[model samples]
Target chain A: MKTDVSSRVVDKGQKQSHFTANLGSRYTIDRIFKYAAWGATGVSILILVWLLVTIVADGIGTLNWNFITSFPSRRAENAGIIAALVGTVWVMCLVALFTVPLGVGAGIFLEEFAEDNWFTRLVEINIGNLAGVPSIIYGLLGLAVFARIMQPITGGRSVLSGSLTLSLLILPVVIVSTREALRAIPNSLRLAGYALGATRWQVIWSHVLPAAVPGILTGVILALSRAIGETAPLIAVGAAVFISFLPEGLQSQFTAMPIQIYNWVGRPQEEFHYIAASGIIVLMAMLLVMNGVAVYLRNHFQKDF
Target chain B: MTDNVTGDIAPGSWSPKRDRAKAIQTIVKIIFGSFAAISILTTIGILATLIFETIEFFKEVPISQFLTDTRWTPLFASKQFGIFVLVSATMMISVISIMVALPLGLLSAICLSEYATPRIRRILKPMLEILAGVPTVVYGYFALLTVTPFLQIFLPDLQGFNALSAGLVLGIMITPMVASLSEDALYAVPRSLKDGAYALGATKRETVTSVVLPAALSGIVSSLILATSRAVGETMIVTLAAGANPTLGFNPFVPVMTMTAFIVQITKGDAPYGTIEYKTLYAVGMTLFIMTFALNIFSFWFVRRFREKYD
Candidate 1:
């Protein structure tokens, strides 16, 4: 007790005492934490740069027009991705065609009409859950439903099956993003439309929706990028491992860039590995262009809003 | 009073037409509402299908043997269906990935939320997220070609295919997921808390470590959990890079098969429908789904409970 009192008196007697000591200690810790944060960002940027550099160095030379134009051949010297490229484009087009209307319509209904009831909340949660479900699960579902169960068209493995599976995987993402975009539109817009003697449908069609288009397009593009790169579900739905021919219809056998890359890289040979890298370069370029457009639209329309 | 005022107005009035429009509005609302309801129904139906098939799969294969048996030889008539080996590989890869990803992810979040300028973050964060937008299959090839050779320099015993390479690449792939989610959490932290720390003569680092990070800990943890789930459920990386040897071991240098990989493997082969081999895919899938589902649910709860209580 005596020592404690003496220390307290000494502390009180000292003008700067514990305060300066605390400040010094805090300064060190603060600097360390800030640097730590900086280090993290630096490392992430480094990894991304490493990936891009390595891919470009390894794959860029092989990415010539001939590589894109030629068809796959059994001979290692002659094989290319013409068939796979065509298949990917077709699948992406079909996927976008199918998902846009259904996904956007669902988003509109939820944003404009659905009440804050238990049912609506349930639907909202369900959509969130679906978004987190892995792409592979969707593949298995596609295998069971599109390939096996409904085999009248595609006999269990075709471009159609692959497209159906990917569409399901990304549908939730589109819906959620679209709903967010719609929600960002202010209530005043709706009220003004009504005040002008416009009906609910007319108001949504004319004012609120036009305002929300940029945001909705952003979500749609992201969804497309996701679909374009997916491999697991397509593989599960029996995407041909060595498809040398182009797909003729929805039901015809096909391969995508990811599947082709997976098959080629798995080989023991070294050259096929390089071919895989070239395919990756192509895939990444496509994704970048899509994402770039999305960013541009977001910025352009955000300014308008 | 309104009638007297309007008595001088024309006979072709807007008020009656507006009433008719209101009636139409109610009908349109019902139609839109039904469309939303059906979208929900489709989602539910997918879940229903998975559950129904999974139950049938269990009936054919006894639950006890499926969980307890270690050697999975479902291809043969004997059907030695133990899922431990595959599950162990999944767990091992997931742990390694979390080790690599967590620090980088959290650090990046801290940088974006507390340190970086708005202009810098706008450019940097999206670029980082572009990594996420890259297909997993690309990462798979990068792992097999680039990462494996890199690992071979240090670990001489490392095979052409090993879990270390796959796990490392997957860790990189999942980094954006963690960073983005954690940043959102940290950004939600109110400025007053940081100001209070600064007013106490605390350094910027002290303010961030002591005040900002704690407030966002729940969000960071949930992000980690979600990233781990993604690693567990990841297929192409493990299938392509991680060698498909369903052996119950822990050596990172050795080839190990994961649950998702096994499902991919059987489906790739000519496994006939209704055969034990085909059914095993479902059984394995059910296990993987249950694990990821449970983790996701836990993560969702954690995010809600630990989220910052902002003004």
Candidate 2:
């Protein structure tokens, strides 16, 4: 009996050892590929890091106080980016003013008032499609509509036309964000409002709207950031490539940072190229600041519920 | 008792007034709902305009020539109505972009889902998204000033503007989309599969490859397709970095005009609205919109159909 048991134990040990050997070799190969995948991801991050560092180092020298205050000069050597900066600010401000009410109102209507039916579904799908539409298509639309059809209204591609074009482009984004915000609120809150003798409008205005405010603001900021950097649409709507004068009214022509950058980069002069780099830095900074603000708002108001 | 009777109006009597209020509410709802309805209508109208204008363009220029002719010199003469030359350029840039984005995006998804701890993921995910928020115009500048000069040092023949540089910049610009979507997909893979592999004495690497990745493959593939669409539709980076040379060449070293680049080129020039050049812009725009629309619809369907819901 002892001899038989010993033989059986030896057979079991052999099987186990063979299994371990095969498994160990397989694991080694697997680990190699896993690390290889990681290395690829690391390379992408490294590329982005390199880009940020290079931009800061090369563009920072031109971001001095005078660069902030001065306007473009004919010599290119004396040009600053004050006009572009002001135009970007003006465009963003107008974008915010136009998109907020329109987007939020649309969101409220869809989420609170519209019936849960095919028409609502169609609108939802449409909004998603619009969000994916190319920004340059919006540019073409602006060119045809805002710059041409409404030429009698604005007298040409002015600040107002550019802002309206961008506002339309980003409207879907804001509506999506706002709808998500509204959806996050509990159904029980609405039930309680109705129980308290509140009308539908009253419940939305007094309860739901306040709950969704932070989200609405967050969307507005992000949409404005997008509008600010948009060059193609503005270019299509005829943002003057080198507007030396500040825009005095809605009818006056204007140039944003992107147009300014494009104008300078195309020039043969190396100095203008440096100025373009400076303009890029300015545009990047604005985007970063707007994004930061949006993130902060998103985090600050994220409900535990 | 009489006072109580008067106070408690019959429910049937109360119903009429409530119905009246509901009728008013319905009208109010319709009025408010018009905004969303009209916005969608406007979007469709834009697409229709593109279609009509493009059709008009095709009428003026033969469809056979526009589709088949290899050389593109519409500005100089009507003899060249070829769309394929510029389409090839766009494809070249998009192919390069996809080559870079695919592996990086997949691996990043793997890292975020399988390798990183919660603390690391919380920090990294937002940082990756921040890349997406950086404007394409900025990426364009980065390509022109930094990337081009950096590439020039090694390749003496590289032009100041080349497809490779633009494609590289677009690759970076598109990475965030691929990564985010793939991460969401990876996260949806069942954790039980990993546990089962571990119970069978499989290593972490084996579990991720055999169990997790296969399960997430469809979502990852869809993300890649969507990223490809974004690369095609992207205008600013190509317009700035890639020069306006509509040549039928596969060489990434050369500057080439993309569809978007051609639109930018035609629109910038003084082309009248009724002219063939202007209508060609609409034609190219329609093509771009159609391609992107198909991709978008596919992605949406994928998300709706295959996206796993974890209870």
Candidate 3:
């Protein structure tokens, strides 16, 4: 009986050896294709490099102070981005003002007060769906609602109308991110706050907001950057591409960096194309700066938590 | 836990501090509730605007003609409002973009998940995010001014403004999105399954193919669906490179206007606020909105259906 058992164990060991199965073309193909995956990443990097190179080559000369300070002109050399720059800043500020409070408050409610029931689940799902809605569609809503329906209030395609549209566009993203930020806090913090005499609002105000600030700030910056680059929706809502003056208030007509770049790219003149390249460089720089702030805040908070 | 609080909360009397706290709590609750309703209100507003305008547009132009006709010349002296012309163009670009995004995206994701070292992953992930963050308008500019010109050199017959360049660049924009989502899916596959494959003397490739890929199949599929939705709704790239011609054809070499481009075209000109021409935008928006809305729902549902829990 011992001899028979030993023979059976030896047979099992032989059957389970690492090289029991012969290597074949399938394995070879997969091994070879691993490099193809790396190659795919390389190709993406190449295209990015090429895009940056092409625009930088064309646009470098147009990045001087005069380019930023001068007003729009029939002459490409004389036209500056003062109006577009001002309009972009105005719109971003208004978007920040409108989106932050509502987004953060909604996030707090969803994380703390929501019952985790079907109604709250539906709301969560609805927010996700809204984030995917095309910006151009938002433009249509803005056109109908802000530009026309609320004409008396928005003053018809002024910065107010444009800002409100952008606010609505970014609100979903803000809410989602803020929820993520708020959710990162430990439940013990809430329980401890309640262990004292603190009300729910007081606990959240004192304990949660400080902890979530960095994450919320990161999300807000990214959302604002997205709003900054948006052009199609603004186009839909009647942003003039060639505005040469600043928006004095919320109701004034405005032009943004993207709209300006878009118009310059479309002009028949070669110089305008070069100018468009410069505008692109500026836009890209602003994007990088915003992203930088977000990264810094994220790192600082991550180190804390 | 509640007994002390209940005993402290006497029926008919309150201190000034408690009264203030109660009032503040009531106000805060109302504020938060209203803030939460903003999202719902946004959805309602979008639907109402689109539907109201679309209903008015259909009263003038029949739905059957809008869907079935072959031409879409809304602003011409003689009008033929065929929605298929735009739908086909949108489909053609969407299909081309998917073809470009899928292989590149999936391969990169597989490579990152299955092969790359942690250091490599950290480096590659940020590069991908940077790629993703480059704005669509910038991509549009590159597609029009750079990619189109480069493609014309090889395919000499390619139009100055054609679907191929726009589709290709849009694919580039979408690849990182696909890679990130798919990588998360692949990462979620349990390690024990992979170890089991190894224990059974399977090669790494064999293990991934038969074990991991199948395990992550629904996630991969949902990523594809989400990518498709993104391509369908993309605007600036197509607007800049795909030309404004609303031609009815499948040729990626020729200039064709997508539904998004049509909306941009009409809105840029702002035909006349209440004209049928103006209301045509809402009809187009309705179609675009419906397409994206349905795709997003399907994506979420597909993901939930295949959700896996591992010990």
Candidate 4:
């Protein structure tokens, strides 16, 4: 007790304390933590750069006109992605055609038209759940339904099946993004349309939809990009990885860039690996273009809002 | 008042144009309403297809042996229908990926949310998210060709087709999900909490480590859980880089087959439609669906439940 009191008296008397905040390792710890945080961010960026550099370095050699124009071959030098490229374009176009109207219409209904009721809420919640379901599950659904259950329409594992599978895989994304775009429009803008003697449908079509076009287009492009990159669903729908011809029609069998890339990556040859990298380069270019446009659209519209 | 205003516009004027407008509105509403039903119809289709095909699959492979057996050699002569061979592989890859992602993602989130200036974060956030945009198949080849070779230089025994490499690339792929999510969580933590820590003479490190982390723990955990589910559902990366050999082991260095890969594998070949072999695809998908659905619901619940609370 005496020592404690004497120590307290000494501490009170002293102008400087021995155990100060900056007098020890506290500052060092703080700086270290800050640097560690920065380092972690750097590490992720570094990895992305490394992966990109490696892909470009290995794949750029194979990404010539010949590669894009020629068909797949057993010989690595002769192998190309002409068929896969065409199939991917066809699938993307069909996927975009199918998803945009349906997805955007659904988003419009749920956001602007649907009443605040249990059924609307259920649809909303189910959309969220569907967004979380794996792409492969959608593939199985496509296989069972489009390819088999609706055989005549889908032609059982044709381009139609592939595109439908991909559309389902990306439908939730499109709907969610569309809703976001729609939600960005203020309620006052919507109310003004109504106040101007416009019906709900008229208001949505003339004011709400037009104002939100940029955002909606951005969302739609992003969804299409996701669909284009998808492989499993297409594979499950029986996309041929070795096709040498373009899809002649919606009922024609097709292959896509990702499946081709996956096929090459699974091969034992070192050359095929390089070919796989080239396919990835093309796929990445497509994705980047799509995402870039989406980003541009979003930024362009966000300023006014 | 409303009736008076309407009477002023046009008393009892139900013109042909007005009638046509009403009809068009109803048609438009009906069309969009049906569009909305497509999602519900899609869900029913998925569930019905899975259930119907899974029932057929179960008749061929008994549920008991399928669950209890240790082997999963469907293409082999023996034909052991064990599900765990794929389950364990999926788990092993997911575990490795989570191990890689949680730390890196959390740290990156902390950096972006707490440490970096808003200006820096604005640039860094999108840059990190770009990782997510790269297709999984691209990542698969990147893993098989680039990452595996890079790792083989260190662990010479690491197989060319190993879970570690694929999982590592997958970890990189999903890092944005974790970082973006956890950053939102950390950002939601009331600034007052950090101020209190500062008033107590806590350093910046201490304020973040003690005050902020506990507050945002649930969001970080949920993000990690969601990332794990993503890794589980990932197909091409595992299918290409992780090998098709469905071994019942947990070694990260060896080749392992995932359920997604197995489904893709059988369906890629000439498995006759409605046959037992083809039905296996649906069976595997059912398992994958249930696993991911549970994880997603848990993640959703966790995010909703324990997010930061303020007056």
Best by lDDT: 3
lDDT comparing candidate 3 with the true structure: 0.88
For each of the candidates, the C-alpha root-mean-square deviation to the true structure, in angstroms, is 5.1, 5.4, 5.5, 4.8
Each candidate's DockQ: 0.52, 0.45, 0.63, 0.72
RMSD of 1: 5.1
- Give one digit per residue, the lDDT tens place, for model 2 in B1-311: 53455458765343224445556666766666876776787597677778888899889888898889999888885558788898888889998898888878888888888887789788878778767877777788788878998999999999988999999889888888898888888888878878998898676777887888777877887898889888988988998898888889798888899988888787766667788788888888887888888888888787677765555
Poorly placed runs, candidate 2 (over 4 Å): A1-21, B1-28, B302-311
- Cα error of candidate 2 at position B104, Å: 0.7
Q: Which stretches of candidate 1 lie over 4 Å from their true place?
A: A1-29, A153-155, A303-305, B1-31, B76-78
**Strongest candidate by DockQ:** 4
Which of the CAPRI classes, incorrect, acceptable, medium or high, describes model 1?
A: medium
lDDT of 1 by residue, B45-152 (tens): 566667777777788878888888888777667768789989999999999899889988888888898788899988998789878887998888888888899889
Native contacts, share recovered per candidate = 0.64, 0.46, 0.68, 0.82
Error of 4 at A92 (Å): 0.8
CA lDDT scores, all candidates in order: 0.83, 0.81, 0.88, 0.87
Question: In candidate 3, what are the lDDT values of residues A66-136, reduced to their tens digit?
Answer: 99898777899988888999999999999999999999988888888777887677778789889889999
Give the Cα error of residue B225 in candidate 1, in Å. 1.2
Residue-by-residue lDDT tens digits, candidate 4, A253-301:
9999998988888888889888888888888998899899998988876
Chain B TM-scores, listed for every candidate in order, come to: 0.90, 0.90, 0.93, 0.93
Give the lDDT ranking, best first. 3, 4, 1, 2
